[model samples]
Target: MTEEIIIAGFGGQGVLSMGKILAYSGIMQDQEVSWMPSYGPEMRGGTANVTVIISDNRISSPVLKKFDTAIILNQQSMDKFESDVKPGGTLLYDPNGITSHPERKDINIFKIPGAALAAEMGNPKTFNMIVLGAFLKVKPIVAIENVKKGLEKSLPERHHKLIPLNIEAIQKGMVNVESVNSI
Candidate 1:
């Protein structure tokens, strides 16, 4: 099986890191994966995006014109990637940053209040993990055990203490995501 995903958000929202962790998790699962990131010069406040592909077999290319899933964190990304999702694909978004809702009849749409939830948890940095958790719950493309291992691999040793908190945020996301619509 192969899943092509695009995650887009404002910089400093952990967009790249989220994709990295997902890629690492795929690796831990013995799956072939590729992660590609794009960002503006402003970084922290500018837009950033990452494309990740996980496959059971060898990956042919990292670039993709369409995605199986699109995780959009802001209005701009929602506008840009909404049409990029393939028919019957999944579209996950954070409602806090969205001005308009997605309109699609062929794909599934879900909403995860990542930013708001992270703030409620008293750690804004966990927003991405929350979104990741929601994605995993909806797709189950990678195991949670592998995700924990991926977090260990992705985070520096000094930050290991925060792993549990991050995991908790992910769990919250899994439970909190709202199913907006389904095909």
Candidate 2:
């Protein structure tokens, strides 16, 4: 099976980091994966996007015109990626950032209060992890245990203690999204 996901937002919002975590977790799971990030000048405050491809078999291309899932952290990201998501693709958007609700009948959309949830978890910086947890809940391609390991491995040594909190944040996000989807 193959899954292509796009994560987009402002540079400091941790969009690339989220995509990298997913790619690294996919690799840990013995899956073929690629994380391609756009290197543009506006990365500081402007848009930043990362494309992650995970597959059980060999990957064909790193570039994508369509994706199975799009995780948008800002309205600009939503506007930019909305047209590119494939029919029946999943969209995980930050409800606070994206003002316009999509009108597409083919694609599925989930509006999450990811940043707020992270702040509620005691670290606003963990917004990316919150959204990452939601992504895991929706996709389930990578095991959460592996993702927790990835979080520990990928983060700096000084931040090791934050892993458990991040894990809890992820669990909270998963529960939040699951409850929303159920209703």
Candidate 3:
């Protein structure tokens, strides 16, 4: 099986990091993976996006026009990638900064309150992990153990102490995701 995913958000929202972690998790599961990131010059508050592909077989390229999943974190992303989801695919989003909601009926749409959850957890940095957890809940592609390992690998040693908190955020997201529409 192959899953093509586009994760898009404003810079500093951990969009690239989420894709990287997901790619690493896929690698830990012995799958072919590709992670390509794009962002504007202004780093923070600028548009950022990453495309990740995970497959059981060979991956020919990292570039893609459409995706099996689109994980959106902001209004700009919702506007940009909502229509790029393949028919019958999945679209997971965090309803934090969205002004217009998704309206597609062909694909599945799920929303997670990542920002609010992160704030409640008293660490807004775990917002990405929470969204990742919601995505995993909808599509159980990689193992949780691998995700833990990926988190450990992606974060620096100095930040290693926050692993448990991130895990907790993931669990919180897993249980809090709400289905907007499913097909």
Candidate 4:
């Protein structure tokens, strides 16, 4: 299977790191993967986005005009990438910073209150992982074991102690995702 995904949000919200973890997970699962990241000048609160493609066979290129899934964390990203989801694809969003909801009818929409949940868990940094967990629950592109390996590979060795907490956040996200019929 081939999945082209775009994860977009503010720069400090772990958008790039999430893509990296996803790419690493694909690699651990023996899948061909590509990750491309983009961010505005401000870097912290400014817009950031990453495109990740995973496939079972050889990938011809990394560029993509549309995506099979779009993970939106904020209203700006929702505005930008909502229409980029392919018909019959998936659109996942975190409602914390979203001012406007996705308006597409051709795709499936899922809501994960990642930021709020992360805050409730007392670890705001786990928000992205929570969103990723929700995505995996909806579309098991890669196994959770591989995702754990991915997290280990992506995080610095000094921060290894947080893996369990991250895993807990992911589990919380998987259970809390809400399927929305429409915006």
Candidate 5:
């Protein structure tokens, strides 16, 4: 199985981190993985995006023009990457500051209110985990146990205490992800 994905959002939304976690999860699952990120200096408020590819066989390159899945966190990203999703692919987004929504009928569109859900969990940092969880639910490309291990590997020991919370946030995402459009 091969999944090429692009995750985009404003900086400070954990776009790169989420991609890294997903990459690590792929590693734990013994899959070939590639992760690449791009961001401006004004990361906190600027745009940030990452490309992650996971496959059962060898990976030729990290660069890609289209993706099988897109995780969009902000309106700008939604505008930018929505068209990049391949026909019959998945476009999962967080509908927080979005003024425009995905309109493509060829790809499947899913929404996870990560920001609001994170706020409801009383910890905004878990927003990315929630989003990741929604992605897992939709794809299940990587196992949850591997994802937990991936979290352990990505986070420093000092923050290991938050893994359980992150897992909870992921579960919330799994339950809350709503199908916006599917074709």
Candidate 6:
């Protein structure tokens, strides 16, 4: 089955990074993938979002109408895309950013405190990784082993030591799986 996901947040919140990880992981898993980020005037502070499509077969369209899943890091994103998600689709929102609750009952919304959890992990920047972990548990597009390998390959050679910490952050997010489907 194919999966389409949108990762949305304000600038500097690593919205693109999460998309990159998803694309990289999909590549590692030998899946057809495409990552499309908003390119027009969103370069400013309006909204930054990326769409990642992973499929076992050839991808038909790069544009997505109903995302199978979403990771919203900011309130604007939550307000903007939560309603557009497909019924039964998953929504992972950063509680630190999103304030409003979704009124839709058809979609599964997981409000993950990724920013706070990353801060507790001693690296506030790892919020993207935390979100990745949650996606791993929910969508599971790629195996954890491939994800680790892709992550190691993506990082600079000099900063390879940070891989373990990223893995830890991922594991911590995974441990909170029960909260994922519920949130």
| Cα lDDT computed for each candidate against the true fold | 0.93, 0.82, 0.91, 0.90, 0.93, 0.80
Q: Number of clashing residue pairs in every model?
A: 0, 0, 0, 0, 0, 1
lDDT of 6 by residue, 78-136 (tens): 78788879988888777785568666767776766788888888888888888888878
Off by over 4 Å in 5: 39-45
Q: What are the clashing pairs of model 4?
A: none
Q: What is candidate 3's lDDT per residue for 1-183, written digit by digit as tens?
A: 999999998888888988999999999899999998864442365889999999999998788889999999988888888999999999999888788899999999999999999999998899999999999999999988999998888889999998898888889989999999988
Q: RMSD in Å for candidate 3, one decimal?
A: 1.9
lDDT of 1 by residue, 1-183 (tens): 999999998888999999999999999999999998864453465789999999999998787879999999999889889999999999999998578889998999999999899989998989999999999999999999999999999899999999999899989999999899988
lDDT of 4 at 164: 95
The parts of candidate 4 lying over 4 Å away from their true place are: 39-45
Clashing pairs in 5: none
Q: Give the TM-score of each candidate.
A: 0.95, 0.91, 0.94, 0.94, 0.95, 0.92
- Taking the tens digit of each residue's C-alpha lDDT, what string does model 4 give over 1-183? 999999999878999999999999999999999998864443465889988999999997687779999999989888878988999999999988677888778899999999999989998999999999999999999999999999899889999999999899889999999999543
In model 3, the worst 10-residue window by lDDT is 37-46
In model 4, how large is the Cα lDDT of residue 47? 87
